[model samples]
Target: MTITAVWPISSEQDPNAGDSMTITDPGEIETLVSRLSESTAGAATVWHEGRELADTDTQMHDHDVMALVAEGYGYLSYIDADHDYAVLDGDPASPAWNGEDVDFPKGSGVSPETLAEALREFLDSGERPESVEWQPAEW
Candidate 1:
C-alpha cells in the first residue's frame, strides 16, 4: 500500500523549518510512527472527522502525524514535520504552500486493515490517491 504524507509549505525566512510530508511506504509509515512516539514531547491535537481524538495534549509530535495517517485522517500542515514530530521549532508561515487544505470525515483512528482497504479501492479503481477527497500535497 502507498501512503502519502504532506507537510505544510515553509517560507524562506525560516528555511530550516520543517512541514509535513506524505509517506507511501507501509514500512516507512511504521518507522515514522515509532520514531514519533519515541520523540513525543507534549500533547498534540489529533482531529478525525472534525472530532478531537485526544482531549488533552499528550505527546504531540511525529507519532501523532503518523497516527493520523494510520487512522486515515487529514490534518492542517501549518508547521514543519520535525517540529510536529521531534519537538523542534519551526516557522509559522515563512512563505510557501504545500497544497490545499483537506478534510476526510470518513477517516478516523488507526486501522491498518481499513487503510489497506482504502488503498485497494484506489488501486482497483485505477484512480490515483490524488483524486480522492483527502488528496496528498504535491512533492
Candidate 2:
C-alpha cells in the first residue's frame, strides 16, 4: 500500500485544506519533518491506500496529527484500523491544529526525531507506527 502525507499550504485560507505528497522513500520523511518543525502552522495527515489515518468521526479528525508545533517538540497520534494512539513522552501540550490550539494529554509530546521515526514506520508499514510507546488518546 502506498502512503501519502498531506499538509496545509500556508498560503491557503483554511488550515485544514492543502495538498499531498506520496512518500515513495524514507529520505522524504526529513522533508515532511522539516516542514512541520519549521512552521507553527505545520501539520500533516498520513494516509494509506487513499484512506486517511484518522478517526471515523469527521468532527475529531482534524486533531489527528504528526506535527512539530514547538521547537524540538511535537506530538504523534492517529486512529488506524486497530486503535487510536498518541505517543507517550513529555507533559501535556497544546499544539496548533486546523488553525486552533488543541490540547494533547501528558506524555503526548515527542521530539522531532521521534516524530520522524514514527513517520518512517508508518510509511514502511502503512499502519499505525510500532516504533514508539503509545497510550490510548485521552480525548
Candidate 3:
C-alpha cells in the first residue's frame, strides 16, 4: 500500500523546524514500528483515525497522531523529537522563522518539526524524509 503523510506549513517562528518523509515496504514498516516502540522512552497513546490504540501490537495504518497531547503535553516538536531526538533548535528572535539551534527543555515543548516527525513515524512506521509537507487545515 502507498501510505502518505502531510504536514502543513506554519507562519510562526522557528526556522530550524520543518517536516520530512520516506516510504517503507510492509516488512520495513514492521521493523521500524518495533524500533519506534523500543525507542519510545516516555509514553503516549497511539491512535487510529480518532480511536486510541493502547496496544503496542496494533498494526499501523495510514492515520493521524496526537501522541503528546494524548500524554498531556503542551507542544509537538519540543515534546518528542527536538527535546531528545531533535537535532537542531531555531533562533529565539523568530523561533519558527530563523531556524536557530536554541537550547530548550527536553521533551517538554513541541516544535512543529518534532510534532511532524512523531506523527510521520507513527503513520509511516518510522520511514521518513527530510521534512513533512502539509495542506490547509479545514477546521
Candidate 4:
C-alpha cells in the first residue's frame, strides 16, 4: 500500500520527480506481500529485519537480471534511472535476452531482429516489424 500525501509547498508547484516515501510499519509490508502472492502469477516474497532499506542483496544487477529473465518469471525491471522495460527471456531454460531499449516488454521466442525492430520503433514510433509480436509478460 502506498501512502499519498499532499504537502502545500508555496514555492513549488509539483512534487520532485524522485520522491522518498517512508514506510513506518513493517507489518503492513508483510500483509501486502501476502495478498499479492495469492495471484496466479509467480510470486517471490522476502522478509528481512526492518533495520535498513534498499539492501544490495534485494537489488538486482546485470548477472542477476539474466537469471531472473531466464527463469520466465514476469517482472518489470528498471534497467536504469532513465531506462526501464519488462523482459522475460525466450526459452526460460536458456539465457536469451532480447528487448527494446526504451519500454518494450519482450518475452521468450522473440527473434533478435524483431527485438531490434521493437527497440527502433519505440524510439520514434516508427513502423513495427511484421514479425515483432511484442507483448508484456506473455510467457
Candidate 5:
C-alpha cells in the first residue's frame, strides 16, 4: 500500500503548480497523524484502505494509533472549521504529503500545513499553539 497526498492548487497562485508530495518515512507519518489528532482535539475519523476503522473515536488519539497500526494506507480527515478541513494521507508502505490549494464544497478552503506544524510543535513541547499563527485560505 502506497499513500500519496494531493491538494488542490488555485490557478491564481500558480498556474503550473502541482500539489502533491510523497511521504516515505513511517515515523513522519506517525508525527503527522499525532499532530492531526491533537488538532481535532482527538476527534477524527480513521480510514484504512478506504474503509473507516471502528471504535476509534472513543479511544484517546485512536486515530493516530490506528493509523500507525493499519496494514494498508491510512487516511484521516479532520473538520476543524465550518468550511475548513484538514486531511492526512499516510501509507506504511509508501507515503507522500502534498502541498497545494484545495477548493471546498463551500467554494473555499485552507492549507493544513500551518496547523500541522503548530500541532507538531505543541506535541513536542507540551505548549498550546496559537490560532493567530496562520489563517485558513479563503476564496
Candidate 6:
C-alpha cells in the first residue's frame, strides 16, 4: 500500500512545518530511514489516507506513526487502532521530535535497521507494527 511520509525540512523550525513524500514501494522506506538515521534532527510521520493510523478524539491533529533517529538510535510510536493506545519505544530516551527534545516513555533503544523494518511493516500492513515492543506514553 502507498503512504505519505511527512518530515521537517529544517530541524530549527516547527516540526509540523515541513515537506512530504509519497512512498509507493517498500524500498523507499529504507531510504527514508537512512535519512533520519544520519541526522539527530531527522524525524518523520507516515500517514495513510491523509489520516494517522491511530484514532484521536480531539479535533487537533495528532500523529499516529512517528519515528525519530539520533545518535545511532531510533524511536518509534503509533496509536493502536483497536484503542487509544500509545505505542512507544521499549527503552527510555529523549529524542528530537519535530524541533525539540522530548522525553519519550521507557523502552529499549532501537537500531536503524529495526526502525526501517518497522516502517516497512507499517507501510505494508497499515496497522500497528509488530516488530517493536510497545509501551504507554508517559506524557
Candidate that would win on lDDT: 6
- Local distance difference test, each candidate: 0.30, 0.61, 0.32, 0.28, 0.32, 0.64
Candidate 3 lDDT, 114-134, residue by residue in tens: 544545554544332235322
Please, what are the lDDT tens digits per residue for candidate 4 over residues 72-138? 2222222223333334344333333333322323334343333333333322321222333323332
lDDT of 5 by residue, 28-86 (tens): 54555444333212222222222233355763331221121111222323332232444
lDDT (Cα, tens digit) per residue for candidate 1, span 21-58? 24444345444333323321111222222222233466
The top-ranked prediction according to TM-score is 6
The residue pairs that clash in candidate 5, if any, are 8-101, 21-97, 22-96, 23-95, 23-96
**Candidate 4 runs further than 4 Å off:** 1-109, 126-131
Better of 1 and 3 by TM-score: 1
The TM-scores, one per candidate, come to: 0.23, 0.67, 0.22, 0.22, 0.23, 0.70
Order candidates by lDDT, high to low: 6, 2, 3, 5, 1, 4
Better of 2 and 6 by TM-score: 6
Model 2 TM-score, 2 decimals? 0.67
- Name the 10 consecutive residues with the lowest summed lDDT in model 2: 94-103
Q: What is the C-alpha RMSD of each candidate to the true structure, in Å?
A: 16.7, 5.1, 14.9, 16.7, 14.7, 4.5
In candidate 2, stretches whose alpha carbon ends up further than 4 angstroms from where it belongs are: 10-19, 50-66, 90-102
**What residue pairs are clashing in model 4?**
90-108
Global lDDT for candidate 1?
A: 0.30
lDDT over C-alpha atoms for residue 42 of model 1: 17
Ten-residue stretch with the least lDDT total in model 3: 94-103
